[model samples]
Target: MRQNLLMIEDDARLASMVAEYLDQSGFTVAHAGDGHSGLARLAPDTGLDAPDLVILDLMLPDMDGLEICRRIRALPGAMGHVPVLMLTAKGDAMDRIIGLEIGADDYLPKPFEPRELLARIRAILRRKGEAPASNSKALRFGTLEIDRDARTVTVGGKPCDLTSYQFDLLVALAERAGRVLTRDQIMEAVRGRELEAFDRSIDVHMGRIRAAIEVDAKDPKRILTVRGVGYVFARQQD
Candidate 1:
């Protein structure tokens, strides 16, 4: 099946250009020039090919792009699973960090070349494929249980919904229960890239993971931080 793409850009000319480019590149593209209309096309009942990916711009006429992203991320089903690559005019670090915090898979600054956008999209999809396959088996680490197949995670048998990145981070740490994984190492394992010194993207992702799996997010037990190093999932005590 051809991958379907949702392009949410308010600029009609740019949107048309992008849609044409993606279509020419063999992806079925859907264009929505505004946030509300984009939501309508992507709304549950539309049965619209359930987009495989979304390219979103931060600046919109009717709504803030971050809020739209949050709403989409909060949705149930494959819609929420679909990867989003944010487009922003600002190259500020804070904006990128916020984008990651709100569940975007990737971000690209505005005025980016179409080819580069395609590359980023391809990279995100490739990582999505590399994610650990889900199964019904549970990894029991003390009071925490991760049932991979069901895509469900429980701490002390209490269930929680984890974002895809959070789930992957937990699996990586849980699989190597006793070892320490540096921020760079974790990012490489979870995101397929080694981020820079100032990059806290992995930390943000782990924060969410800890919140879901640990008894307390503030004073985490299952995943412990080793100052100036990285983090380790404490070996379960027998």
Candidate 2:
């Protein structure tokens, strides 16, 4: 299937080149030169199907990319769950961390090779597109319910906000229920690949997931840190 991709970038030349490159890679590309237009395109009333993935530039003319990402997560319904691959300034590790923490599925530094961008795009989609056969069933623990088929997590009957990647990560841990998983093990389980050196800590993502599900993120009782090892998802929860 040819995937539709939306690229929200201020630089026309870069966007043109990227569109051309991604087009040749069998993706249909859409362009929004500014932030507002990009959000408009994603609006539920726009009548166009939401793109499968978004390639977002962090430095847009009308709005900072982080703000846009925050807004994207706040969009009503499934539109808020669209996968995002952020483009950031080279060597800005903090920005990349912040992006992932805020729901971006992945991030690439600016001035990146088109090939790398393509690879990252594929990786993000791969993580979101396929699931182990078992996910068709819901995983429930006390008051925390994870509907893998629906890709939703609800605690005490209230929905918990989590990114697509984070949802998968949670599922990966839940499947193993009492086992302790190292960071690399968690990443491999969720991404189906070896952990990359450039990849940010799984710890950051863990924090985000906790914030969404735990009644108190500061004292998480569900997902516990193993200290000096990794983390373990408690088999029993309330």
TM-score of each: 0.85, 0.93
Q: lDDT tens digits, residues 77-135, model 1?
A: 87877788899875567877787778887778778889887877777776665535444
The residue pairs in collision within model 1 are 135-148, 135-149, 136-149
Against the hidden true structure, what lDDT does model 1 obtain? 0.78
| TM-score (C-alpha) between model 1 and the true structure | 0.85
Model 1: residues with Cα > 4 Å off, grouped in runs? 131-137, 156-159, 194-197
Cα lDDT tens digits, model 2, 1-238, are 7999999999999999999999999999999999999999999898778789999999998999999999998888667889999999988888989998888888888898999889888887887777654848889999999988778899999999887788888998999999999887887788743445856647788999999999899999899999988999999988
After superposing candidate 2 on the true structure, give the runs of residues whose Cα lies further than 4 Å from its correct spot: 133-135, 192-199
